[model samples]
Target: MTRRVALGVTGAASAAVMSGCGSSEAGAGGNVKQPEISSPIDMAATQDVPVGGVIKANSGDVTVMISQPAEGTFKAFSSACTHQGCTVNAQNNNIVCPCHSSNFTIEDGSVTGGPAEEPLPQYPVKVDGGRIIVG
Candidate 1:
């Protein structure tokens, strides 16, 4: 009886650890509230990304992409794809939706494939003091 009980506890503990591995540190135990991060960003030394290019910015629970329509011009949008809210990681190519293979043009965040009808929400960004600020 003692050995069985010990094994049961061990199995339960292992299952708990395995289940918690599916989420980020803030939500390891589930119910991860969105974090509050309003600190200003310092984008000094960042190059002026021309059109057809992308720059990644990490803020809060989402990543921001700063692209441009032409040299010295810039546009910012969410890195998360609208479909299924997947993180679009392919910076060199169209923003891809991982859940359903939806594609989005980097220039305007238009849906190119999959079931997503909405584009990524634009986030305002500007260069100040030689640093890019996303607000």
Candidate 2:
């Protein structure tokens, strides 16, 4: 009877601990929950980004840096720096990381200067009906 009681107590404790992992918020392990984008998310309008310029935009909790390298061509990448996960800004046709002084190309998100070795993650972008769609 004592062994049965002990087993029951352990099982209850384990179940209680495991329940927190399935929470709707960020996990206790600091893992962030990415927002589900079932369809292409519209980030900005075509006129919002100028030719030969870059712009920063957000879709839900995701930050994106977009560039118009030519008259109508558009490119987009995750704004988070690969070096230390710091948010980068679009400046002077480059993605500049304020935290580590890393720079990435606006056209391809390739590292142009380091501290950072990996390129920024690229997202699929398309212009549809004067709207910029990203995913």
TM-score of each: 0.61, 0.71
Q: How far out, in Å, is residue 35 in model 1?
A: 9.4
Per-residue lDDT value at 97 in model 2: 75
Q: Taking the tens digit of each residue's C-alpha lDDT, what string does model 1 give over 71-111? A: 66666666665654555544464566554577777778788
Clashing pairs in 1: none
Which residue runs does candidate 2 get wrong by more than 4 Å? 1-38
TM accuracy, model 2: 0.71
Query: At residue 122, what lDDT does model 1 achieve?
Result: 69
Candidate lDDT (C-alpha), each? 0.61, 0.78
| Candidate 1: regions farther than 4 A off | 1-40, 43-45, 48-50, 60-62
